[model samples]
Target: MSQMGPPRPGASMPAEKAKDFKGTFRRLVSYLKPRRKKLAAVFIVAILSTVFAIVGPKIMGMAITELFEGAYGQLQGVPGGGIDFGVIGQILAVLAGLYVFSSLFSYIQQYMMSTVAQDTVYDMRQDVNKKLEKLPLEYFDGRPNGETLSRMTNDIDTIGSTLQQSLTQFITSIVTLVGILVMMLTISPLLTLIAVVSLPLSLFVIGPILKRSQKYFSSQQKNLGRLNGHVEEMYTGHQVVKAFGHEAKSNEQFDAVNAELYDAGRKAQFISGIIMPMMSLIGNLSYVLISIVGGVLVIQRAISIGDIQAFITYSKQFTQPITQTANIANIIQSTVAAAERVFELLDEQEEVEAVTTSVLARAKGAVAFEDVDFGYGDNLLIEGLNIDVEPGQTVAIVGPTGAGKTTLINLLMRFYELKGGRITIDALDSREMSRHELRHNFGMVLQDTWLFNGTIRDNISYGKTGASEEEIVAAAQAAHADHFIRTLPDGYDTVLNQEVSNISQGQKQLVTIARAILADPPMMILDEATSSVDTRTEILIQQAMNRLMAGRTSFVIAHRLSTIKHADLILVMDQGQVIEQGTHEQLLDKDGFYADLYRSQFSAKVAI
Candidate 1:
């Protein structure tokens, strides 16, 4: 489906797609409620069309009955008639007219149903994406991007397709089926009873198969997610895989996944497919028995020819809805599976909602963390950590790797819920205020610059919606990205595909920095912001950072000690604690852990 070759060629589909469907179906129904008007319209059209279909057959049977009665002299001929031309013409005309009306409503029915289905999908995708945006950074840890994307795209699409077909068609078939049954019961209850007797048998036979199919269908969705995740991992790390000559291993893994998916698909298909044919054969046999009884009754003069004709038509109609429903077992399972995945995401509790507050005064740029603690789960990354970046000051956080520098920054930005302590802008606690209100006042440039496939202008102006040309350019200039951007052929309007291999890594970092600068927040956070740049670019970024930090609270984290040498205050961290806090000169005087780290770094540089 992803053009990634088949699913991982050897991995098996899981047995449980999820725990249960009750919660999922309930949530899914909520989305449908908003568009109920359209659903009602579809139902109306389907009912009308079914009525017309029944009328067409009834008219034919009536015409035959009229002729038979006239020939047998049971009824006097109309004005000039053996089945009068005018009467026949009227019936035929009404039947034709009803059919035309039916076709018109059918068209309307399909169009409205499709619109409802697709629009619901569109709304669902938007909602999921919005939820993801609000979710904390921890939500994505170890979660496969491929699996998430599949749920948003393929899984959502499956629900849309099911809505388009099953919802409207099933309604139509059911109404038609019921109308036929009523007509048959009116004409001959005995025959109608016989025809539908086999119907219950269908449900009984399909019940267990449906259960198993449901189980397999759920597993199929999950396996598909895993397969996508594996393929995405392989694709993203293609260079490493090739460099390590692991193609054979990759192929073997993929083959195993693919084989499992193939087996699952085949099995689910067979299980669901068997029910419909079995149902149809049983229904047909019932119809044959009913027909034989009806014919015998007609021959014995116990039932009229017209009545028998209508009964046969009713018999076909009686079992048709059941047949159609049975046939859709596979599709229904697919829908349920997809719905389960989508609902799972929808059900994940969103982090604290950011309330909207009145616009505040421009930031005076004071940030403080008083006794903060945080971690992904049971493990604590930072405990009782306290720090401050005064207005117009640059403060740096330095530590051994995984000393929670990034985790700290994430907490300050409200990317994760702080387990303990308070982070404040100026003097107000971040939790007491709205996230939007607080975050709108700071700019953060991440270490990994996420670039969208758009013109360079789009990426830079991403957060600053409705930004003007001069504003974007000015920000770029301040970040030192203007020079490189001008070097590009299209300047501001150059289209950048994901294949931005031609650009240097430092250039992209500068571009991201420019985006943050353009945002013009009262404060800024730069975490290992210059980790990958050359000495020259690092200096340039540092200079731009210095300018950006002017009159603003700034927090910087860098592994290389040389870059953060000018920080107003240095916070030395070790194992989730602030072991030391001072200016660079003050720390140098202590001659402790920071000094030792500095020495080790220089020694390593010399060895290299």
Candidate 2:
């Protein structure tokens, strides 16, 4: 199989490698530790089943030998020695019993294993979910949603499937191999040697194929993740693609990723596909050699023909397990790779621990950023930035794109840790409080209005769980969303689909505003909350925002200059520096950068 070269830029998921297999396997086994008793039961039952199953060939051999000897004696003129019907019946009955018991034990083993597998994966997924909640926002910020989704879904699913399928098969294959090898040895050691000798040849044929297939399988999984990410990202932004006439380029990129996935998948499948045939070929050669040697031994009276038959059956059984084990070996490689991906996410650095200090109960909404220096990675975007806000003051931040306006907001919320400095609320550093408590103090309405698949009432109440229906209605009324909610087909009970495209963008913004209003936090952060609305809707949103912002410290990242004209303090930012700061009129009177920007908006309005 050909290895894939460097991936296309942004058209790939993080390339997955088979790393720390032993450690991952060890951790994986730890999931089974709690269910050790059940696993032990499964192990014992599998062994008993294989033992029972292996006894059949030897028993059948004895029955065949008895019949053969009886017939031979009759041919030599013994009158009543033609056949032993009673003995044959007994042997058949015992064989049936062995088979029945074997099947029963096998069934029980499978049931136990299924329970163990499901339980282990259930615990694993729960741990991963908990880990996700504790991870810093930057962890997600630096990766694509699809990559995260892949680990949570696809990689975990791989672990689940391998557990459910491969784990039991692996145990069964090993047990069967040992059982058959023992049975063959009892029947004829020479024939067993022939069978055992073929083992090395099988390995010689399979080892290289497996070693090569692993890389392709790893590549295949990665490409699959990338393809899923591309599809998800493209579909999520489909409207943008169509609006900007970028569908051709999008399709071209999708094709490139899809082709990579196909290449890796085909190579992996093709390599794994060769294992069974090659093993069968080796088994066949061994069988011929065993048959010739057993025939010669039977003529020499060293072994019965029935023993030869039994040996042949054992050889077939032996090779079957070997083939299955080899396939399972390949599957384990993929499973390990998947487990590594899941464990990597589970091992991500969590948010910084809250320090022990006085908790800020009933926050006064006064916030301060003191000597705050921070960066996204190594790029120092915000340096020595300091700001202080009084209770119930509206601070409007205006900045060009990438001017660190939102980054500042992110720091204020502790979504990203400060490189050096402190963010304090009510004179207490935010790090002193639990993240949940710290975040609970602020209600945010971002430019992107995200509404899940739920009712209008549910979306509104998302900010305040257990909020009564009446409270939901009140919040909607305050956000000027109540009338529209009532006008909808199902009113508050309307179910939203995954896309949430059922409502207009302005309506979605209203829903989010209703959510924020319901939260009723001490502080509010509105980042262009009205950017998605039309002029009329913007007027309504602005009015609702004014009501929501009442008696709360608010940080408004304003895009439209007119919205912030009445703000208590307007901050003008350029290239990550505070270029100007004062009341709107005061800043405008200075005739500086603020004035030029404020004038440009009106000039554009006049031109229009």
Candidate 3:
């Protein structure tokens, strides 16, 4: 149950918190490479907008000085001269021009960054899905459906938003902040000195807040994943919960995690909220310090009034950028946390990819397991085994619970690699062949039936993607599913939303069987294929399966010993190994595990 993630970095707050912020910022910008030209446009626009923003205030200060010095007339001849409407018009025109550029560039930056973010996320999703298909069954065995889905949906969305918005904002803010600093120092180092003195204090307050926020933010997401997993469990097992009268227990478990998530979310958000207000308060206080001192210097006539006005404007300018810097730090931290999780899936070692490909090589349905040893991870499910099934033979594998029945099928399909030994189809090793080539030879019907949200015909034809309508109907008839399928609203075209939930369980199994039958693989695996159906339906499906196994090598894993009485080779497995092998009557006479299981299960059914 342990997560196989790398050691988490720098959760504990370092003494130099700003240093950590800078490091995280640098690392986050590394993913913007593939669209460098588009991003470069964003960068140029961001710089221009920030420059104009700083220039706007400087222009206002210049306007005030122009009125005082009689270059532009003063309002109502109040200070030095009459107002010059002509020059005022020019200033306003330039200001409007700069506003136009800023607005237009804002749109461009957002459009470009959003495009990059979405495209990169699209690529990530496809790659992760491909990786999931490549990973061995063991990886999925330890996880629940909801958690895996949470990783795919909620987690991916979080990563996408962070990459799209946070990356753009943080980058723009940095460029803006640098411009403000340079302007502030150029206007007056003395006032800029007093304004920037608050930097150490802003860091002092926000450092701990960032660290605490990061921890709680991470915990909140983990709790979200758990809550999602719990919800999925409840939904899938709703019948069990209601039947056992354990709904109260389930509710209590859900409430406990819900409460934890609420607390963690509030704590993280509260810390983030406190940061902005504190930064504002520090900025205003710094603004006041610079304004008061600069006013005194202007009154003493040591500095020009115009210089003092620009100095005051730049003081607040510098302080506003400082506040912007704090939000940038927070943004980067949250994004890194999200990316860390996303990258985990991106970097997982794909289930050993095959070195050879032979898709056109038709298997002769000769399957041999030579000295195979395997397990779900380290649990040791199967050990050093040997079995051979020639073409056109029906092999039945019978076993008790946890006896590795389905495990054998997984090995043959290359869903899990053999820990030791080789599986060969017509002399070529399974590992040497591409998984698509190896699995192409199989038509499998699992005990747990799964029907996607599609029409009955669509479900059946899923295996054979390009099958004609005649072929689909033919496969359905062979599986005894076409009769009921015809009763639906649109018949073969009737869409089954949220799975084929309206159909009976036996019908669902039949439809699944039809899907496999449509593929018409050279080998088939029926793993307790009829375990869910009624006696009458069981017989019908059994008849269909007999036809399926006629010319193909087939293996049936079942607990119903009666079903496999006529198997060409019957394997009775125990504790992950074959304890006995023979047909039904042959095993009944062995007086071994097979006989005892047959006596317990078959005798009761026959007596009934």
For model 3, the stretches where C-alpha displacement exceeds 4 angstroms are 1-30, 67-80, 302-310, 357-360, 377-379, 606-608
TM-score of each: 0.87, 0.95, 0.89
lDDT value for model 1: 0.80
Tens digits of per-residue lDDT, candidate 2, 1-608, equal: 01111223477445666767789889888888999899889989999998999999988988998899888988998867788878988998999999999999999988888898889889988998999889877776666678779988998889888888888888888999888887887777777888899888888889899889888888888887788888888888999999999999999989988898899889989999999889989999888888888889999999997888888888888899999999998888888878888888888889878675768767899899898888756767678888889999999999777777887888788788888889999999888888788889999998988899888888999999899988999999999999998998999998888999899989999889999999999999999988867999999899999999999999999879899999988888876668899999899899999999999999999999
Better of 1 and 2 by lDDT: 2
Per-residue lDDT value at 566 in model 3: 86
CA error at residue 369 for candidate 3, angstroms:
2.8
Best by TM-score: 2
Best model per lDDT:
2
* Sort by lDDT, top down from the best: 2, 1, 3
State residue 6's C-alpha deviation in candidate 3, in Å: 21
**Order of all candidates by TM-score, from best down to worst?**
2, 3, 1
Alpha carbon lDDT of each predicted model: 0.80, 0.86, 0.77
What is the Cα-based lDDT of residue 13 in candidate 2?
46
Per-residue lDDT tens digits of candidate 3, residues 1-608? 01121122211222111224445445445655677888788788777766777677666666666556664345455564876767877877887887788777777778888998998778768867887776666656655566667767887788788778876777777776677678767777887778778888888998998877887766666667667878988998899999999999999988887887798788878988899899888988988888788888877876767767877777666656666667766665665655555555566767777568544367888889899998755666678898888888899998877677777877888777778999889877888888888888888888888898988878999989899999999999999988988988789998877946788899888988889889999999988888878999999899999988889999998878889888989988777798898777788788888889888886798799
